[model samples]
Target: MISKRKLYYLLSPSMRYSIRKIYYFPSDFWDLISGKRDKTIPPKGLIFIGPGDFKRIGEHYLNIFKEQCNLLPNHRVLDVGCGIGRIAIPLTNYLNKEGSYEGFDIVKNGIDWCQKNITQKNPNFKFTHIDLKNDLYNLKTEQTANNFVFPYQDSSFDLVVLTSVFTHMMPDDVVNYIKEINRVLKPNGKCLVTFFILNEESKNYMKSNSDFNFQYNFGDYSLMDKDVKEANIAFEEKFIFNCIKENNLTIEKTLYGFWSGRPKNESFDYQDTLILTK
Candidate 1:
């Protein structure tokens, strides 16, 4: 069998990134064939997918944001990597007129959907399409993640969110984004971000059983599939903590996830949740 590292080197970067989509195509095709398609689902080419994932995961994170961070109806919010307005759709009814939402993503289709479907109906909710380069999704963009600055004024938001964002991001980019999140947040503002944290317990759990085990330690992080490094990245817990502290953000709370074989009652979502305050 060809080793993952050898296979990674054999394929071009684009191929390595795009091949993961092939794995999901069958499942996505079944969803379409079964007539389960909806406006919530992005087009097949633009799929960051899972059928019914938008509604289910959105509500799960929203509840955590509300409970742990004291998310208020009137607070200004920012949703980084706000794919297809999963969180924005629910917040449309939850947020009052005084509250406003700003979300940005590299994928044009998701942003366009949010603009037309969510923003047009609710003017306060806004979406921006950022052409940032990502090997897996937006390989054509000239802008790289490390240098891309978030378009927002200082101390602009009371709450900033990054659901499944950092999990795909490289370490430098993650650190840069954390700094931007810190700069834009108001004093005592909170950020709800999710990641696949590789700690002693989670690592041990992964060794025993888990569909996605990040076995390849690629320098700063671990990868489930070495060929597609960004498909699933798990960072060291200490590195993440250092990034938060270096950015001047304080961790308010942490809820471990069930992804590492933890019981459902003991965990939150599939990724570890960190509630950080600026």
Candidate 2:
């Protein structure tokens, strides 16, 4: 029998997304009437990305931002792939009037729900819709991620974030985004991004099949699913480091995760988290 994940990827991107929304709609409807869901949280049917508990994961990142990234209430924040306000909701309570949040996503409905729900209460929080093409998430959009320019001024943000966005992107797209991150950040600004960094240690860990093994080799990067281009990508360590260096961004820290078979209890996240400074 074909595995469910492989079978799911066989369907077109539009069909895959529609099927997920449909699958989760009944529970979301029930939660709406029963008042089991929080106001800031998006309905399950509408959430297009990310894994694990929605509210908990958002709060978890908030803590990381405050504790690890030294995020301040008055600093400007940018979320590259703010899907359904998972990270934005927690930030609303944290950022004071002097601070602001800007997020953009390819999916229109997530942005619509966020603007209607979150932005109404917190005027400082804003969302913009950009229909960019990705193999797993979006396909019909005219714009390509590789050369897309961020609609923002240079040296504007104090902190930039890309939680799980790069994992779904191609190498060229990520390189361009890194350059954009360097451009948009103020002097000494910080960026906290996550990726699957394929270094020696991570390679050793992936010897077992239990972990997230990027078995399909594709030069500098590898894919979890061979045919599904954007399903999950892991970049070689040298390529990632070189990209950061070429973009004039310095690596501040590297926190490897448990996805490559490291002890789960010892890891902070499933993907390797890197803190960079510009």
Candidate 3:
């Protein structure tokens, strides 16, 4: 079993640095953060591109963003798990001058990197460092002793997004975040989230691999193992639908295969994009 301390170590700044290198974040972005350069040029190449080539990978995420968010010029968007400004920066550009964007993450490095690079040109964009692992979901005005603050008032945002964030969270934490999203969202607001879903096909695929196991608890399902075991954490389609129902949100759309499941040539079936309206 993975302990909370091990998870913290994995998320530590030094470990994150190594992970970034392994993931091939732009060298200039790292150089700027390390004070090796006075100024840095934002990377133009696709950061998440795999052996499939850039155009194919770009089309995948672009379509996912468009279908999931249905982004508009006048929208106010909150990106709950903005990592290194991957989606948030590009999304700010996509929204142009008519919209406002805010992003928060558990990692300070991500927030700091975004503020330094993306927020420079997009003055309306903002980033905050918030530790969601702690029970600071309510985010009161005077509760400034935490790692960061959420300045916007309740029901201020038109959309809130938690892309690939729920895939790593415990089931209780996932429910809490759904409640918090409801609290921050306006009556007409929407939320877009992505996750790995464990259905029958996924279960069979895991069984074939012999390196995975599916664990089910009170309707919540996850795959657990030693190496890449945390990837096992997943939700049933009904669990997501029920969470939205309980929160009084309506499902707008669902997009499948954004990341293409395992057995690499399977054509991006692992990711699920959900758009929910309040």
Q: Ten-residue segment with the worst summed lDDT in candidate 3?
A: 134-143
Ranking of models by TM-score: 2, 1, 3
> What are the clashing pairs of model 2?
none
Residue 215 in candidate 1, Cα distance off native in Å:
1.5
Error of 1 at 277 (Å): 0.5
TM-scores of all candidate predictions against the true structure: 0.84, 0.96, 0.69
Compute the lDDT of residue 264 as modeled in candidate 2: 89
TM-score of 1: 0.84
Model 2 weakest 10-residue run by lDDT: 208-217
Tens digits of per-residue lDDT for model 3, 1-278: 86653463346344545564666656656766887643332233213111343334434554665665666767788888676565664565467677788888765656777798878878989898775442212122333322333556789788888766777665666776787787788887888787876666666665655433454443665545223433336777778778878977888876664232355455344566678888
Clashes of 2: 0
- Give the top-scoring candidate (TM-score): 2
Clashes of each: 0, 0, 5
lDDT of each: 0.82, 0.90, 0.62
lDDT for each residue of candidate 2 in 156-180, tens digit (9 for 90 to 100): 9999999999999999999999999
lDDT for 126 in candidate 1 is 98
